[model samples]
Target: MDRLIEAIEDKQNPSVVGLDPTPALVPVQVMDAYHIEADEYVEDDDDNLAATGAAAAYFEYNRAIIDAVADIVPAVKPQIAMYEALGPAGVDCYTMTCQYAREQGLYVIGDVKRGDIGSTAAAYAKHLSGFDGADVWHEDAITINPYLGSDGIEPFTAAAGETDRDLFILVRTSNPSSAQIQELELADGARVYEHVADLVEQWGADTIGRFGYARTGAVVGATHPEEGAALRARMPHTFFLVPGYGAQGGTAQSVAGMFDRDGSGAIVNSSRGIIGAWRDDPRYSETLEAQTALDLVAANARAAAEDMRDQLRVALA
Candidate 1:
């Protein structure tokens, strides 16, 4: 658990790459390299492409992104929906991506957002907490939905404690629809999410690492800057996994409040904005050469990431 905190502290910048693979957005070279028709593959459930080229494309795209940003960001988060849509083949790629990310010395956050009953939840925890077996297990932290309360969270909490892994509970999510529920005020005057935050903070207390931050964390969106800041202040020792940056339109300045005084308490995540930027951003693509296409696209993406980090520094300073 201390290793998790130390890894975050060492990076200084709390930016995380959200890997949500959309086959249409992958570079042609990557597509050609593996003879993968990702767009067609994702659409056809019974297509043989699922087991053949689709799985290969999944690993290739992720490997490319990891190579590009591994040096810059603290972690990579694979949105489970993208991988799970492919079924077991996608799960194999997810497993490969996790292993590759670990080898690159970056943390992996399984953005599965799973919430279930106690017995079933424990099964998920076992598979995801890297306790089932090293091959198919996820060694890093995962996101959990607390809508079911302690019954859903208890199994995850237990697994995290045993494995020294971490869980980032969804307190105030970034999606627009979240306001309908999370913002509802209780008779006690606390918003529903506020109470969730308090509970998450309490759950993480025993999991605190030596660096003064806990393995228990929260996924607060960068879209709600003020709320994110207020939550940061409320849970000073908790790690924050922030989404909604880049493609979701969250500016670095808007999310700057997530950082502590030293600028190391939270991580901002960007998925389509970083990986799929080449589709619209010509500064990256518009290349004819295969190698050049990969390099230019990767370069532009890295530059955008660096610019975001610089803005965060300015805002924090």
Candidate 2:
């Protein structure tokens, strides 16, 4: 938690670029550039070649985004599901992306959202605590699912403590369907998310860092401004990983309350808005060379990240 806080303070930006790239988000020229190599590797397997090519393009795209915004933003949230969609090749791309982001000195937040109990949970915790002393994942923090209760979360917290990493538990998420479970009222007259928030605070009680935030943070979506603000008061020791910004319709004004008085405590994330910025650029053309297209991606991403930071600065002020 301290490390992350320091990075955010250093950059003076509480925003995290989400490296959740999909096929549609990537430039067609970039994807096409890898088809020949993918074909060579897959050798007659069309499906494998397509996946391999997509995975390759995604890594290049991620690299461009990381290189563009590494200095402007403190962290990056790479949604694992986006990589997993392409199977093993995509998983490799995800790890490569994390490694690349970290190499550029940006904190990598693996948006895995994993949940399970006992051994399975411990295995997932390995993302923070690398197996055999190798830090394969290269993530500084990760998102977790709390539906499985303490058993599901304890392993991650323990790993975080041991590794000096952090975890953000799902609380009030950004997606509309999240309310189906998180907003349900319990017998004690508290919403499910509120109860979960208390547990998240408790989970990190012993791990509070110099900045007054615990390693166990909460995932409070930026979309719910009122609730997010209230949670800031309720979970005093808990930091926040706020999502649902940009492409999901969350703005700086919508998420301003999630931060503490000093404009700390939360890091907002924007996926498509930053990485897909090139799509809206009139200069983009499908016929452009891959490197040229990627150059546009890098330029657009940097501009978008800068715009987001400026917007947040105004809102927080």
Point to the candidate with the largest TM-score.
Answer: 2
lDDT tens digits by residue: candidate 2, 97-205: 9999999999999999999987799999999999999998999999999988998888999999999999999999999898999999999999999999999999889
lDDT by residue (227-252, candidate 1, tens digit) is: 99999999977889899997777888
* Residue ranges of candidate 2 with Cα displaced over 4 Å: 43-46
RMSD of 1: 3.3
The TM-scores, one per candidate, come to: 0.89, 0.98
Off by over 4 Å in 1: 36-46, 131-135, 280-292
Q: Each model's C-alpha lDDT?
A: 0.79, 0.93
